[model samples]
Target: MEQRIQSYDALFELMPEMGAQKELLGCECAQPEYCFTHYLEPGYKEEDILVEICQSVTEKKQDSGQITFKVFLKVSKAACIFYKGSYNTLHKSYAMLLQYIEENGYEICGSIRESYIEGVWNKESEQEWLTEIQIPVGTGSLTQCIC
Candidate 1:
């Protein structure tokens, strides 16, 4: 987590204007998230974690040579969860979402993205932090069963 902040600091050093709101490539809002971590997985390996710490920049100027960027498009159907609380308890939320995805018969097609909506900057406590988790799905679309 500290590393991600350090990267954000590095990004800010390269582009100070990032302090202002701007739209990111894959994000829907103009307000930038503190950081986005994508977990690329059909299933995560117990021995290793696949995580990418990154943020979206608006224009070419904000993008420096030191940074590498990628643009991801939205998927046809996504299973989303809005979580509020400390980062430590995030695993519980992930469990809920993953279970939902599995039960609904959705095959994850892209990276699982976590975008911070609010946190340390605005709220005093970690309990107030809000995040959105989006998992892209495919395989003939979702069919929710009440069984």
Candidate 2:
């Protein structure tokens, strides 16, 4: 596993069903109880934001297969970790990538940015899913709360 820091352009993608939380909350970016994925500004923590966002929407659980809305981060100075594996074993890939990042003196600064480089459910078995685990680097705190 290899980790390299790189900058990225801001992006906004929508998730119909956020895996962690599933409820149709309206689309209000700042709602403390809404359930929509959003693009965090450059210097923010994805995990903290995700928790707050999940709270704003609701605290109810849904069926296992329910599709929930979620968001992906648009990051800069990200430590990129690329790998190929079965979906079930992808966690190992992340662990290895994190180890490599630590060995190289980088810290996980934000929510893990994931990109499916391959295996879109329409590809063959020989082609394992290629994903990039982009963890942000450099920070004073994981979050910058403007209270």
Candidate 3:
């Protein structure tokens, strides 16, 4: 089988338009416990982060006040790493992952995706939290370089 990146469309529970976590709790959502909170931020900046939750179903009907969206991620090639630690130390992992991609002849092509596998409620220790970093990449080529 070809070692190609896999991409997919997913339903995401988004933060309220105002980007308030407290408002999210007030919004009606079913079985919120099963959802894992994910963050999308530009360049790992804390202030730029947007909170979201991955949904189990793609066609889930949202309540009147619910904030959600369907998004598709295209991952043609990528460098992935599993991180186990506090969110505060993710910069270390990101640095290492970026180095790995550069050494392997791939360049980041899109926004990074951090999927929280284990977190606060499930894990007591900050060191036990699990996160997966998916950095979309693409092979360098003259065609790409020209543009």
The best candidate in terms of TM-score: 1
Candidate 1, residue 45: CA error in Å? 5.8
lDDT of 1 by residue, 61-140 (tens): 34433344566554567788999998767778889999988897767767777877777667999889998988777665
* Deviation of model 2 at 128, angstroms: 2.5
In order of TM-score, best first, we have 1, 3, 2
lDDT of 2 at 32: 34
TM-score of each: 0.64, 0.44, 0.60
Give stretches of model 1 more than 4 Å off. Answer: 1-35, 45-48, 61-66, 140-147
Best candidate according to lDDT: 1
**Across residues 18-37, which tens digit of lDDT does each residue of candidate 2 receive?**
42224343333343322312
Write model 3 residue lDDT over 21-120, tens digit each, in one string: 3344453334433243444444544343454554433343444343454445445566889899987787899899989998888876666767667866
Q: What value of lDDT does candidate 1 attain over all alpha carbons?
A: 0.59
**Per-residue lDDT of 104 in model 1:** 77
Where is model 3 more than 4 Å wrong at Cα?
A: 1-42, 50-53, 56-58, 62-66, 141-147
